[model samples]
Target: MDTTALEFSLPNAAAEPDPFSIADLSPEIRFAVLFFQRDHYCTNCREQVQAVADRVDAFRARGAEPVSVVPEPLDRVEQWQAEYDLPYPLLADEDAAVGDAYDQPVRFGLLGSVSDFLGRMPQIVVLDRSGGEGDPEVVYTYSSNSTFDRPSIDELLATLDDLAADGETTSTDG
Candidate 1:
């Protein structure tokens, strides 16, 4: 499926009573890293998180913040944090509410028969922090397999730079 056609609505994190929100987040070009893990048992989970963190660092160097949202417990997130030595904050979605908001379904593998669903694909939602509420421009989106097909940190950073530059010009004009 063409990822560009996928529509997303912000998830209701209110259930968790977290202070984090689109408003609480530091306003600058921001990227939402959303991942759905069935059991958090993937062998490459740590590696993928680190790869994302590395990309986030590239964005940070350019003044952009990347927020990773994972559908897992705080403990799991913490474990991943320590294992991956991530620099960015990781939000926990214990109920998978946030993931569901993005229409990210749980995948069922061999464990599917016993478990609820399988892990979701790694997806990124780029928001122009300066854009209005109706719909933040989705600069990019990728499928679960896209993790392997994921763009390099350098490429993602360049793309974000272009988007931010474009936003600055447009905002100034308006």
Candidate 2:
């Protein structure tokens, strides 16, 4: 069975308020973000982040805003923005609070010891415009060890299409 076909459990809404809920954003559009570690960088992470940023317009065309969230400092984010030539905002989650909210965890199991810990895998999350309080659907997910088989840009676009086709109007800000 393909991992892509597996349904991911939504985050517990009561666990904590979504970081996006605190932002003053447009309620007319859906929101999505590629969450990543702040200081730790990996070639695969860079590739995945760039891929999403490059094709964000495709999401916008479908009435969604795509962004990248990292646990980096403002200066580092600016450097990355210039280096990557990012078009959308690159958020700074300084304390990894956002990452924690997303259930990102660094596991030492694979390394055989706590000293050999590796960062959490990359993940993409989609949020409905209207915040009614509950888990938002996880349209796509891939483990850190499974980066080689991560979905392509086309595949992600298709997934978004399927998610939007469900005929449910995302909640709206009243």
Which parts of model 1 have CA positions greater than 4 angstroms off? 1-19, 29-39, 105-119, 132-135, 167-174
- For model 2, the superposed segments whose C-alpha errors exceed 4 Å read 1-22, 37-40, 109-117, 130-143, 146-149, 167-174
TM-score of decoy 1:
0.65
Backbone clash numbers for all candidates listed: 4, 2
Clash list (residue pairs), candidate 1? 107-117, 107-118, 108-118, 121-144
Cα shift from native, residue 161, model 1 (Å): 2.3
lDDT accuracy of residue 128 in candidate 2: 52
Summarize candidate 2's per-residue lDDT along 127-166 as a digit string, tens digits. 5543434434444443344334356678667766866777
Sliding window of 10 residues with minimal summed lDDT for model 1? 8-17
lDDT of 1 by residue, 73-121 (tens): 7777667666666666566666666656655433455463334334455
Q: Rate the local accuracy (lDDT) of all candidates.
A: 0.52, 0.51
